[model samples]
Target: MAETIVVDPITRIEGHLRIEAVLDNGVIRQASSSGTMVRGIEIILRGRDPRDAWAFAQRICGVCTLVHGIASVRSVEDALHYPIPANAQLIRNLMIAAQFVHDHVMHFYHLHALDWVDVVSALRADPQKTSELAQSLSSYPQSSPGYFKDVQAKLSRFVASGQLGIFANGYWGNPLYKLPPEANLMAVAHYLDALAWQREVVRLHTVFGGKNPHPNFVVGGTPSAISVGPSSQASNSGTALNMNGLAIVQDVIRKMQAFVEQVYLPDTLAIAGYYKDWFKKGEGVGNFLTYGEFPSEGKSIDDLSSLMIPRGIIVDRDLTKVQEVDLRAPEQIQEFVSHSWYDYSTGKNAGLHPFQGQTNLHYTGPKPPYEHLDSEQSYSWLKSPRWKNKVMEVGPLARVLMMYATGNKPARELVGMALSKLDLPTEALFSTMGRTAARTLESKLIVDEMQAWYDQLMANIRAGELETFNEALWEPSSWPAEATGVGFTEAPRGALAHWIVIKNGVIDNYQAVVPSTWNAGPRDTLGQDGPYEAALRGTELADPKQPLEILRTIHSFDPCLACAVHVTDPNGEELLQINVT
Candidate 1:
């Protein structure tokens, strides 16, 4: 007999998640991943000033807010045909890299590590040994035994200080998770260390953005004034020689690069040895996709000479031969709301781009929709995005594959080194484990690249390359009567696309195809699973009550449901409703 098992209120990650599994005795049958809460962000965005959308959109996810801000501005810039300054491009890339470091460190240590390591186990760790480990890994004076003792002392104080907010609802003593006491202690110490490191690195965003989490960024150009003298405002005209703050910014970048190399990278490798089993599981959706990122050079999409991050698509696990990515190319990309509550405008097919979307409501049973792609038939608010109408992977794994396929020397070298060190086959880089490992490896490369960009900025500054324009002189009356534009950017998750239509200087209509929408959408009208869905199929569930493997695999993608990212509590007590038979 088959019975349903549910693990609700999944912990230690962003937002909430519910995992429902079907089991026959000890064997698994099927699984359903659910996001149980809803807050209408789209409804909130409607009728608001198009200019203010960035402010609200950034708040959609506390983790990757700056990414959303950039995506939003890129959309508006597309509509306005605005050209950003070269220096602005470099600054944005640097900010993005800082966020990458901040996010990855936080995710690995605080969020994901908690699932693998026991915080309480840290109390028994030998502080002197940990300091020795740190020092042996790097020649830094800060990694001495005394340093780890202070770190342990701080952790104790943190728990006693009523500031265990980050550890609320944590399950450190759970028998289901297997973690060595020593490893646990090290992770706990690093957790505090990372929190401090992330805060310092995140300031890069504040330098350019004026703040972190959500900063004021304009589409055409930055809302900043540069000054060469005592004030940066004078440099707004692009001719000022304000090298004061820029030097400080570059120095910080150098420091961060050192930390990622000497600290975070080593930590990841050391921890990987403890959980070598992960190398065998969590591989999903081999095909990867990336919309070229970091546009600075005058290069076209096909010619990435000018862009800091190149845009392209990869398939068949081949990243070498990239094809031009055109949203209007064909009907390859489609959306299915059948399983969802949304009323499908088309009964027979997935919604096509530009005109395709969902916003209707239907109350089906509480169970997930396994048949139709319509939201009315589905359980998730996220719409499934498909490439060539098939689920394709997107994330660091995909990005790295695409980069390597394009012969990115730095990424290739790092990936090769990681694979070799892990004692895994090089071919394994194309699997689920590859995707997770790729994220960490790519981060190391980006850390170095950020420093490279900093050096480039120094060269340009010395060579008299400066920003001459600050404010955009706008005449509302002279604004176009009607216009349409497409904005594409490489978000931290993957490629994000937004299309906007404006009339009389006001947004007539707006639509966004978020990264999670692509990674976690319901089936399209054709009954095709999105990337996450396809990856979920065939995954083993040893215990229905606690399917840690599946959760790790899914969360490995780092999904952020921009529309609604909440997961609800199952409340333990089951409610039974009787009906007349």
Candidate 2:
């Protein structure tokens, strides 16, 4: 008999996720990934002003706050055929690049490192040996023996105090841990460094958008204006985009570059050396997709050739040929909710594109606090999203593969370097570890590119080009009676797109197929498993009780369920509530 194991409320992720796997003699025979919440943000956007979509859409996920805001404004701009100034385009590029670097560093060190680094073992590491190993990796400037000693002492005090704080509830002594105590101590030290580093880097968003999470965005262009003089209305008394502000932005970009080169990239290669075997496991749905982002020129969105991250699809692990994606094609992108807690007016088995998507809740699984889900019926809140009727994996791996396939120089160089360092072939870039390393390499690529963008913005400013917002399409009466558009971008996790329909300058319909929805969705109407389930199907668990292997693969995708589903109650009353300390 195949015994079932349930891991509900998977910890250290953004929102609630439950994984059910059937183990036959220590090997996973099958698996299911479920999102336990429902999101009605789309429903809330209906009948609202199109200009206000960015404000509401940004609230989709607290972690991925800025991506949604950018997508929302782009959707409205695409619908109205609004063309923003070149300076605005450059500023937007810089902000998005900062978000990628900041998010990837935080994800690797804070969110995903504990899975590989055993904090309990760090106390046993000799601080001198750890310093030697850290110095061998790169000149990070904080690799002194005293620094490691302080970090190890901090870990010891936490253990002795019986209050682990964020380190609580971790599987600290799992046998699968591969890094030496020295390596573990090094990772822990950088993890603390990243926390302070991210706080300073995010000021780029604050300088440009006036806030960090949920930054302000406009439909026509960015909300920021170039500061030419103190008398300019856009320039405030404290500090705006003035010369001092520009210098601060430049300094932030340099800091981001240094961290990726010294701390983030070198740490990934060193840790990857210890777990080369992981490069062969957790390969999910070889099909990859990216909507392409960061336009290199001030061109129309229709011109895919100018994008820094090329848009295309790779099927069945074939990289020789790239299939073009058409977001406007009705049959290209569709969502199916057969195994999800939702109904479509068309039919339960039908697939609807975002323009015609529906969100009618229909929960039929066992009620809350249950031991196991009845997998035969609706088992999750996430709908299965498919491209051309096939499961596709999206995120760093997808973008990196797309860049390599398209002959991108920077992507190829970085990937080639990382693979050479680990002594692995290109094929190794398809597994769980590859997914994590890809995020790091992509960060370096983006950080390098940021310098060119910043230089361009400065050149434009020196040339006296200060326009940022396009007010030509600000009037509601200027739009046609009905218009629809799709905004697509490559988020830190994967491809994110928002589709909107406008009637009389008001939103008639809105739908977002977030990156997490693509990776964490449930089975489709045909009973085919999504990426998360497919990845876990054949994984070998060393210890079924701990199941650390399961978390390794899932966290590689950086699952963000909060973006996929939201809370709702059809009975018009609070179903359940709890107070936490």
Candidate 3:
């Protein structure tokens, strides 16, 4: 008898996903990850000025929309070889940092916490005890006894308001939720605090991008002008000696720095201690990868004038045994459409870059046509991406290992400190739990760097390096008529890259190999499963109908929509295509 488990419309995260697991005994034998809703943004981008692509791409995802804007601009810049000033680099970094802080905090509390902390359990919490715990954790914000009572009262009111839309049909009261009622109450209180903090960080983007959800950044530099005297030309001039504008952004970053160190990091550690089992379970793809990030001052990883973290791949039984990366090598990356709706030549060995990409949806039945394919193609619109012609994992696990191997001293030291805090031996960094811990650890490192960068900007400003912006775009002819460039950056989840081909001032071809394409991919031609697919095979299902364990494991990676992946239904009314710039 095949055991069947179903999770209808998974809650707490963006978009829609439904999981149906076919089980043999207590283990998942087959799993289906369904993409539940349709949002047509790509179809919307067609026939518009490629210049407006970033603006529309940003709307594809509200949480990481800035990344889309950044990627879009980078793609254009790549096509043009537009050189951005030092000030522009600093400004872009600041915007990305703000998004990182905002996304991580909201993800932890608003989305993932309800799975671990029982909301209904909070009703039994003692307000006095909660206050005492808060006081004990000095890293957290100070609150008086009455403040704790007020927080509890507000939570009660909010709950009674019947506005638990985010928490609707949550996994509350599940036995898997292990935190005590007091702990749950404390977390619930922090959830509210996180909401406010997230809003504050979002301002960092507003100051730079003009709006949240999607901000505007120019190809040559930022849209905002640096204030230096009355003339607009002076605003775009480099700060050869002045340092005023850099200081403004630097100060804002400092505020965020203090919050993460004194609040966010400590909070994650505290929460992790209560959920120690996560360290052992849900470990997928021990091999790690990073496309490098945040270029160091004066160094270019791939010959790009801008600073980049570095790019490399590591596969070893031991974490320390990892090696350097070679992104230039062909055959390292491949895309499989065997089970997808697309029509492609079978077993063809060729580079299928995004510009030469193909996405033609076909449906023969619920079951895919290929013999190696799934019995039911009832799920996601995302196609599986593989490395070295095989499915490989991506994200924190990949980033942590890469950072540990090729990153600066600070990144390495931060990883070391995280391992120590978890009480696992230093070598334990090689496990699944280490991946989760690495993200929290790596975030701290990024936060610290952001603060220092801010201080550097301010110091330069105080030295009279203040300017509003750069005007590299003034001479459009400076750009080549035909060019190809790759824009790669570290999104909050993992490595993200965009490749663009430009001809006659328009995007001849554009492609994005998103983080999800690597982590959530399906099986390849060789019959090997992707990271998410492999991870699901070993998970024990208590009830096939409600597999919380599987959901918890897969969601840890936090999959985002891939712009290049699309499903088409010829019979449907006009094929839901989105276009907004």
Candidate 4:
């Protein structure tokens, strides 16, 4: 049997993944990605009110909290031809932008950074030298020698405690780790700093949506009203978003922009400099997909043209040409369950559009305590989704490439700056390290734009336009008998879309083709490998017992197993369990 590796997410463990790799002469010859759990949220959504869909759908992935809700509400609004107020659009933009910045930064410092940084190595670093190195990169305030000493001390205590926890001193002597002791210590300090910084940044969500980790979202517009102007009620009086709340949001945006500019962007480039060889490997299937998001003022949610991140597709790593993406067209987007634990009314080989997607459970693998999954048959729970019969990669890499190909001036400039700073060519953007770099560059671009979104929202308040919810479609009695629509967003992880079919004011069918599923799915009917499988094929594992290289490439894609493999039974019974022997 080939070696089976179970990779768990940093935040959660139950919803994890397994990978089977065939090695030939120290290099991976083939790979398979298996989402161990199955998602049944779509099955649960059937026969529910379309307007209440966001509340339940938002629970799909606790980490990617707001995007699902946003997509769910927009899907219903699209089916009902709902148009929200301009102020509402700006608020949603701010909320979504906050989600992006928050998600990316946390992923970088907490999850992916450890793959390249060795925390145990930090114990050998000189605090003064680490401080000097940090000062040379960016003028972040916590670059003092004393600050480094304090961080090193805390990290040392954590390691010596013998209860390392998640930030444990893992892989102490791994040879593949390229960063120096000073660099590692600097990264470790920043990781702890980000943990504290994230607390304040999330206040933006609380100020706008009442809570985080699934903030409130309505189909037509925002859940809160504007309580602006001095003559009106004070801030936080009832459900109105007053000036005080906006001020808090503005402060959070400033903090986010500052952190990205000083910590996240510099740290990424610094780490990439030491691991330049990674740029030559880990390229996925040369196709990219992005569903545009953050529509400008007075623009429809379905309109991709005016989006901050334009919707488009890039094939064969070609930056010169970008094809249009039509989500609603049946031929444009499809999901196949050929190698997944699911059944379709049509044959397994048939690819169905999201509007007609199903969630039938059918596990066809070895029982628990098995050595490995049979790669030739059904393995993963995620169904393979394709665009025009072409396998595509979705996420930060795709978003950056699409923005660059479509000639978005800021995206182009940021990509150029990152490449030039790293002294790498444009073609390097397709590699595993390049994928990680693209994530950082996009974070910088998104954080810089947050100020403008906030400014516009405040400007609308000054103009006395305080309406948030659209009363036009609040009542289900004004609904059509049957309708279908697709709502999409360039989520922090990748392109995410929620498809809804409404009949008699209730959801007849609902499907979410999330980012993780697009990038972490299994092989299709034609025997074509999915993005994760294709990217892992040529990976040269330094040590079979400790395949840190595989983890590096997988983390570059930032796999969210929960998003890909979700679950719940019709009768709330435990569906399946696998015990590793």
The candidate that wins on lDDT is 2
Cα-based lDDT at residue 563, candidate 2: 91
Tell me, by TM-score, which candidate is best: 2
Task: Write one digit per residue (lDDT tens) for candidate 3, span 50-124.
Answer: 567777766667768688777777766666656676666777777786776667767767766665677767877
lDDT of 1 by residue, 264-375 (tens): 7877777676667767665555666677676443222223555545566776665557765666454755555555544455552456564344443433335432331223
- In order, how many clashes per candidate? 39, 2, 27, 2
- Cα error, residue 77 of model 1, in Å, equals 2.0
TM-score of 4: 0.96
- For candidate 2, the 10 contiguous residues with the lowest summed lDDT are 572-581
Instruction: List the pairs of residues colliding in candidate 4.
Output: 38-566, 39-566
* Descending-TM-score candidate ranking: 2, 4, 3, 1
Deviation of model 3 at 53, angstroms: 3.0
Regions more than 4 Å wrong, model 1: 24-28, 39-49, 153-165, 168-179, 231-244, 296-309, 319-321, 355-376, 430-432, 468-480, 562-581
Off by over 4 Å in 4: 1-14, 229-232, 362-369, 566-581
lDDT score of residue 423 within candidate 1:
84
Q: For candidate 4, what is the total of clashing residue pairs? A: 2
Candidate 2: segments with Cα more than 4 A from true spot: 230-240, 297-300, 362-369, 574-581
In order, the Cα lDDT scores of the candidates are 0.63, 0.88, 0.62, 0.84
TM-score comparison, 2 vs 4, better candidate: 2
Error of 3 at 169 (Å): 1.4
TM-score head-to-head 1 vs 4, winner: 4
